[model samples]
Target: MSILPLLIIVPFTFIILALFIHHVRIKNALSLILGLTNFALAFYILKIVHNAGMLKTQMGSWPAPYGITLVADRFSAFMIFISAIVFLAVTLYSIQSIDKERLKNNYFLFTYGILMGVNGSFIAGDIFNLYVWFEVMLMSSFILISFGGEKAQLEGSIKYLILNLISSFFFVAGIGILYGKMGSLNLADLALKFSRIGDFPSLFEPSLILLLVGFAIKGALFPFFFWLPASYHTPPPAVSALFAGLLTKVGIYSLIRIYTLFLHHYDYFWNPIILWMGILSMVIGVITATSQFDFRKILSFHIISQVGYVIIGLAFYTISGLAAAIFFLGHNMLSKTNAFLVAGWVHRERNTLSLKDLGDMFNKHTLWGILFFISAFSLAGLPPLSGFAGKYLIIKAGIESNQIIVAMVALFVGLFTLFSMTKIWIEVFWKNTKNEKNDSEQRIKSNGLPYRYMITASIILALSIIVMGVWAKPIAEFCETAATDLLNNQKYINFVLG
Candidate 1:
């Protein structure tokens, strides 16, 4: 039996246990244990993939292209590992940050369901199976988004649900059309079939377009991104962090997986469309974020801009481009989540996320302030942080691929990002608004929540950002290898189809 399945199994096991347990502390402990176990399992799987190149298993012992196949190559393994880190961090943070009412209502169960879906999506070897995993993720996320049942949460959940359901419709419709034409849902088999159909490639273009729209909407690119900022700010910061860290990235991961497997064959059509989407998303996302007054709203909008970096890297279609995209994706997950975790702390202490009301946070808690500084600056692409390395590689890849204009746009976005981050820093940390409550009163308000858990979680992610930046070379090298594995689609096809 391969250990790869344990990633899914462990979370499912916990989900079942959560249903029978009425004790909140026990549930929290179980969730943490599940998180730690899954993290270990994901790390072990990554090591296995590193040593073995790829790992595969067929449910019920059915052979390739017939059975439900789960395969982990370099790229999938890397994503799973990073997602595990974010999940564990969020799980630990949720102990204190999530309200007890939500906790009693099976928050951990829904969260574990999300983990199962995310892990399953990464390892799924066929297109239809991928869709199933997507539904699983969305179902869990929808529940989490609406868990509070507050008016704002209900409004946000409605928007979130309708948009994602539309995305799923697009995705499944594409899958149906594709299977009708190709007579296969296995990704490897479809790739093989498509490789042989070079003459009438236009026949499948409609299906591809549908799929692209689905992925783009889910990834929150360009015009399809409005749903993100509208809903993300409405969730608890912990829930928002989980969604920010994992949900959108899965959509991007699927896009990259399909692109390498077959979509690249239509690069002539996709190149310009993808390039401009990236550019517009960068400009529009930052431009909108600059006007936001809420802490999470600004971060939510920046998620769009950061995702643009990844998409543009894909547009370059070079090894360096893909490597940078991969690295940037990982960096954004950690930094963005950490930023949200810090926001959780702010919300906990001040009971509001309005920047106008926030001031002297640094004086109140210098360590939390520093944590926010590290994450915010990292997102702004500051030196010696992961964002700098990611942006540098993306720009370098763009220039190397003769897309100088795109590279320049990326540089400018970094500056705009810096501006937004600085605004947050000065407003939230440096300025001393007259509305400041007495320190003792603020402490008493926050004292009910176990602030230590929130701080610990933020520190964990903050350190990961710093470490990723300081160790950029080795991680970047690993991403290069993952990128190579992705670009060399025949290797993936061979492993899965054999």
Candidate 2:
């Protein structure tokens, strides 16, 4: 009766169907249908979790630490629901945004593959399975990143592959060491075991550190984040949007899940490390982003900066802090992806993402200009948008937790973010360009492409950002419940083990 499996099943089914369907129209139609179906299913699953608190299913008649388990508490259910929304929006955009050759090459196939991996990771009940899902994501993403086989795509995919593979090695190695020490892979069972250890487990901390390094790299945290900016812009805008929305977030989710289950025991050792990494990631990411002119690259670096906000929130380790982290994560997913979606439109119109080459976009496409404004300012933490609410919650939590320095840093990062976003707005949308190559003919040629799909997709996500902002109170309260559930680790352990 558990709907958890359906999240994985629906995407896997789409992948299979995509294999047989050679027609591009059929594939796009199927992808949209499957995306809608999955979104509805995710919404229902979240509703059930809200009513029932938690849901779990054991596979193949096995039980507890011996089985393939899927579990969803409020946090995971909420992630699944948000991911479904982003995935659906991207699918709609890709219908018009992706080129025909890439469509022929099974772009949607790999995209659905990512959806499967993301859904699986959210519900994975064991560390080993979590790693497996990560690999699933990496493989599909590797192919997508290089699908066009452009020189830049090839180069970017190489860096992405090498760095993520290293992440995999560290993660699987940590899993091995943990299993050797603890004798179980199931998360709840592992939590039960870790909680029973009386003294601070020095031996276990190394394994946890190894795991953290892996996650930090995967999540594009400070010093481990070079791969994201180097590569995220090389892909088509739709692909970049997908990666921005869901992939790094899985790594962040893993960090939160593991910290709740195991790492929190040694707060003394981990808190400062997490806290400072967040501080550096915030300052460094925003500063670097300000130097970028490429549209997607700027947004890519902001991904790092925004993730740091979530990290600092987690470091605070209070119910408010975790809730803010969760809220921010969801808000960033929508806003960041929508920014990239608008960038796709920019590319389609101008054939380049260089801000210097893009100007007077507001004059040509007024609605897209508005769309970019909504998403960009929201990301800058401006008022009456989801990003503002998210950042407000995080800073308030930081102050309430007496982390004044970190709160101030977060506030200033928002200012830098606003500056960079304004730069993009001014250079790309407001200022008129002097480039003669982009004449009226060129604009008409690019504008001739079917735009309803792209416009509809951008509107969907833009509306989501507005709704989350206007209705911030109820959403933040739900996030608080989810955070409380996360902090209360015993609830998770008991549900899975029982």
Candidate 3:
């Protein structure tokens, strides 16, 4: 009955209906319709949450702490709205980008499953339920990653599956320990329990460490992120885009949520470790991205680097800090996913992912070249674009927190990020334009496919980036409000327990 549950239900309903309808076109259309429906529903929910404060529903009319609870505040509603938009855009792009045989194998169904999982993660009220949504996401990603049966795809999927299963083990083990210690799965109740305990700090450390290890793995943070670059480059572009945009973010969101809600007023332990982690992830990710020639691999590394930007904001542990992080999170998804989509288009036109093998984009398709530039420059934190706005806010926050070294590291990384984007721009778009003989890109095996939908999707995303960058003040205000909600621990505690 609640809007929170419908976020998960919308995609799930379509996936089930897909089983009965045998027509591929009809099924794919339903996928779009599902995305659109969820997108609209997400706005309604957002408006309600914005107007009504946080909304909570206990399953089966049950009381808090005992029932499975679903809650949506500004942060959760914002995530659901943005995710639905990204999914819809990707689905539109996939109409032309995806392989036919893969589509026949119910790719849309798997896509919907992922949609349900991600939406579920945004609103789940308990740690265990969050883990359940993760399993749902993992299974769908496994199938999508391994689809088409390519040797590389299978290899990537295996490593991904293995690492994530191990992460799941740690997650469940930690959850078991937390429940054993507190006898509560409800996050609000768990927080209340922590308040009453004398040795809360000691109990919190082991359990939280275990949980963060799993989150770090899921979020692809340094030292635990090797699985991502190995696997992400192997999937179809659409799958890769969706994964790049949404999957790891759930982990990041969990970290933010748990720390703000359950681990309130604890700063002595988490701050330094997170600060160093962000610095390391940013430095390592940018340096690696600069060295890469594979298009998607480059973007994949950037995902790691950009996550560092978000983490840097979280590390600051202030209102402005969290707001900057939230803005960066939204900005990165648009820019990063658009970059992946561009790579897919390049592969479609020239059938290559290697930058050395791919060339003369400016002459062959000036339009796509321009679009790629917008996305690339945006990722590089160029002015009047999403990345610049996000990076600026993050650095500003870091400086305000008096973490001058951290801010300096972030700024340095942004320059290198620009260098990597420039490498792609010159290699893929400008290098071959000089040699007209090599400028002739091979046409698709079939030219019957129209470029309209693909271009339309890119345009929509590009415009969003531009608009968000220019109107960043409004977004920053909203993110600040969400941060306020998270920091106002007593308010959330009272609401949940009531």
How many clashing residue pairs appear in each of the predictions shown? Answer: 0, 0, 0
Per-candidate TM-scores read 0.98, 0.99, 0.97
Q: Given candidate 3, what's the lDDT at residue 167?
A: 91
Off by over 4 Å in 3: 198-204, 433-441, 444-447
Model 1 Cα shift for residue 360 (angstroms):
0.5
- What tens-digit string does per-residue lDDT give for candidate 1 at 1-498? 988778788888998899999999999999999989998999999999998999999877889898888999988888999899999999999999899998988899999999999999999998999999999999999999999899999999999999999999999999999999999999999999988988653644888999999999999999899789999999898999999999999999999999989898878888888889988999999999999999999999999999999999999999999999999999999999999999988887888999988888888789999999999999999989999999999999999999999999999999999999999999999998685346668778665655777788888898889999999998999899999988898998999888
Give me the runs in candidate 2 sitting further than 4 Å from their true place.
435-437
Candidate 3 residue-wise lDDT, 1-498, digit = tens: 676888887788888898998877987788889878988989899899888889998878889899888888888888887787788889888877888888877888888989999988899888899999999998998999998989999999999999999998888898998899889998888877776774554734777788888888999887788999999999889899999989989888888888787665466778777777878988999999999999999999999999888888988999999989988989988888899999988887767889988776787678888889988999999989988989999999988989998999999999999999999988888875445444333444435566787888887788888998899888889989998888777677788879
Clashing pairs in 2: none
Q: What's model 1's lDDT at 221? A: 97
Which candidate number has the best lDDT?
2
RMSD list, candidates in order: 1.2, 1.1, 1.6
> Model 1: which ten-residue window has the lowest total lDDT?
433-442
Candidates sorted on TM-score, descending: 2, 1, 3
Writing each residue's lDDT as its tens digit, candidate 2 over 408-429 gives 9999999999999999999999
Full candidate order by lDDT, most accurate first: 2, 1, 3
lDDT of each: 0.92, 0.94, 0.86
Candidate 3, after superposition: displacement of residue 205 in Å? 2.5
TM-score of 3: 0.97
